[model samples]
Target: SSAITKSTKIVLNLESLGSLPADEAGPLARYASTIQAQRHDYNGKVLSIRTEDLKSLAIIYDMSPDELTTRLIEWGVLSPGADGSIYTDED
Candidate 1:
């Protein structure tokens, strides 16, 4: 038998946030502050935050994490990773 576990972190690209129009990133940055997400900046400028933190963010938008992910994708803020993970903060 194999154990299936969900990922505990959400990886985002810091540069993507920077590329967002102020009108868009402004509110997101504000809401993000509320979550007080613990950020881990990597060499690639990726920001990895706890999944729970993203869930908290989703709740603020009245959405599930999956829905939020879809929305992010629509906004060009997230994309599907090579491994089939729909988790990336990039255009």
Candidate 2:
């Protein structure tokens, strides 16, 4: 028998956040910061994010909403979508 452990993989292109438009990048970053690595529970991630945190993170990291989307889809982290959104199915 084989052990099948489960964990989620998230990729944020922390380089292009500045290069892209806020309207576009903002939402994605809003989505990314929700995946914070924490110091409490086994995985202290939240189910959602806030608008302010996304803005702050974008100002600090090199994340780009456009590039991040393509890469995440390629890496199988996100599912490309309509309505200008990407998705992850983590359990």
Candidate 3:
């Protein structure tokens, strides 16, 4: 017998809880609660998403890459590097 697993990384922000629609928000709220109990400083920690998912997720969310980037940046999950590159605090 064999087991297979599939998973992907996703970035989140403080506003994520409120911004997400109800269906999506529920799971995220649960995950946040789990983390909050495990780490006192979890609220300040940065969760970096894989760069590869950016464009794909943007499309899935019906947004252009630029729009997604802007939203992420505004949410404080993504940052613009001094060298004109995009990065996350965890990066």
- lDDT per residue for candidate 2 within 1-91, as digits (tens), equals 2111121223233444334566655655454544543422223322333334434444454654344336446644445444445444343
The candidate 3 region of ten consecutive residues with least summed lDDT is: 1-10
Better of 1 and 2 by lDDT: 1
**Per-model TM-score on C-alpha atoms:** 0.61, 0.33, 0.46
- Candidate 3 residue lDDT tens string, 1-91: 1111123234556454456665644544555555566665464545444555566566655777667666656655556555445655543
Superior candidate under TM-score, 1 versus 2: 1
| Candidate 1 residue-wise lDDT, 9-87, digit = tens | 4666556766778775666656544444433323445555566666777787777777776666666666655654656
By the lDDT metric, which is better: model 1 or model 3?
A: 1
lDDT of 3: 0.53
Cα error of candidate 2 at position 46, Å: 9.4
TM-score of 2: 0.33
Please give the distance, in angstroms, between residue 35's alpha carbon in candidate 2 and its true position after superposition. Answer: 6.2
Worst 10 residues of 2 by lDDT: 1-10
Error of 2 at 58 (Å): 8.2
Q: What residue pairs clash in candidate 1, if any at all?
A: none
RMSD for all candidates, in order, please: 5.3, 12.5, 9.3
Error of 1 at 78 (Å): 2.4
